[model samples]
Target: MAALIDAIDVKRKTTFELEGVPYYCLDADISSPTARGGQTLVRLRMRNMLTRAVFDKTFKASDKFKEPDLQTIPATYLYSDGDGSYFLDQESFETLQLGEAMVDDALELMVEGLAIQIDLFNGNPIGLTLPAQVELAVRSTEPGVKGDTASGGVTKAAVMETGLEIRVPFFIKEGERLKVTTETREFAGRA
Candidate 1:
């Protein structure tokens, strides 16, 4: 049996030789935060070896990862007509369509030909991560009433370029750029 030791036994930034292979100790922890749709969810925080960027992401523990080498591909949004989503791989120039289940609420924020980064596992697309903030055109909304600012920050419904209606501060008008929270579809502020 291989020797087992507490994860803390390794010193930070210290390299160790194991089985003729050199390895650096990295701090990481996995936790099942919650269960959704009958899947065990896990959150992980890791640093990118190349960029040194710290990233935290959640995933289903049941999903098998072949290796730590996860690939990020630039894909252009082809189209999504409420049924499914399609994209074009910029490097391979191949077209791939993902089911609605895979795309999830991301379909609500997509604009045709929009470039997004997709994470792939074993050549299969797993999840999509979008920009923190995206400027979208407001398609429709009620005209702001004069003196409406007196209210205690009440919001009104506004439709976006994607036809998804969300509540925004009364000052927002049609055709204006508004920043939205991609997760909750809430209005962050006027762009």
Candidate 2:
């Protein structure tokens, strides 16, 4: 028997199968029962684990759902080739390649030797989970003019080692390490 999940726990990043299709919940808008004992329901926004298409759904009461056969594996980032980025599974010692389209915005955070969690469905790579924040070195940025603090600490465009560009304080410069939030691709602070 498969593990089951309560409807309320079905939020962002939660995986389950609906009508035999695997999906990851992106968000849920839950409406509680009214004073008159109105029906409670939860509206869900979810994505297809395979096709990456998004859809909306609604669940009532404590709808129990069978958890999909999804597995999380530790992998090491290798390098991006013409087709996609390469990774090595730490446990199985096998290499896997995820297509560029599959990685999406994660390409901005990927670096050689970075540890990541890969989501696998039926033994196939489906998605990735990166560290909440990562330290990446600034590859290049325009030099800040002296006394530029007068601009109320204006931000300038800087490129990271992985080629992701972000607005950073002028005081930052080339060859500096910056802590960046992977989810938003925003600069958190100096590393």
Candidate 3:
């Protein structure tokens, strides 16, 4: 049987179908009645899971949206070819090619052989779910200025194995592995 959902139960980071199109629920908000007799409404900010188009919408409590038919498959990150990132699905052994725009900056947090979640909508690759943190090897960075103390408030720019640059404490050096936050692309700490 097909899945159905009430608008009130919709949550962020999940996809729900409305008007027969699947949308990623980025955020949901409920409005308090301004006047004593005013009707309450719910607002949603959503992105088209396939086309990447985003928009805001208002809905009533009784609105029904189909739960998106999605499957989460485990995949291993392969290599990138400048224009796209590739992944090998564990179950099917099929390579999924996602364009740079679709992959966005998430690739920075992924390295070869990393386990990742691929979201398939109607059996087509739609998006990814990444871990909160990843460990990346530092490729290069300027030598810390002489005498920068461990407790001092100074940071140096370092390039990672994935070619993304981020500021790290002066104590960081080339050839070290550091944990990075996937969402903000910031240095977390040594791995």
| Predicted candidate 3 versus true structure: per-residue lDDT over 1-191, tens digit per residue | 67888777777887888886789889999886879977677899999988889999998767888887889999999999977899999998999988887787787788999889998888888888888888999999989877788558799899999899999999798999999988889999999
In candidate 2, position 97 carries an lDDT of: 93
Write candidate 2's Cα lDDT for 109-142 as tens digits.
9888999999888788987889999989999999
| Model 1 ranges with Cα > 4 A deviation | 1-69
Structural similarity to truth (TM-score) of each candidate:
0.61, 0.84, 0.87
lDDT of 1 by residue, 79-150 (tens): 976667889989999987777766777877888877888766447775566777666889999988888888
Model 2 TM-score on a 0 to 1 scale = 0.84
The TM-score between candidate 1 and the true structure equals: 0.61
- Candidate 2 clashing pairs, residues 3+ apart or interchain: none
What TM-score does structure 3 among the candidates reach?
A: 0.87
RMSD to truth, every model: 11.4, 2.7, 2.3
Residue 116 of model 2 has an lDDT of 95
Q: Each model's C-alpha lDDT?
A: 0.66, 0.89, 0.87
lDDT head-to-head 1 vs 3, winner: 3
lDDT of 3 at 93: 99
Give the CA lDDT, 0 to 100, for residue 127 in model 1: 59
Better of 1 and 3 by TM-score: 3
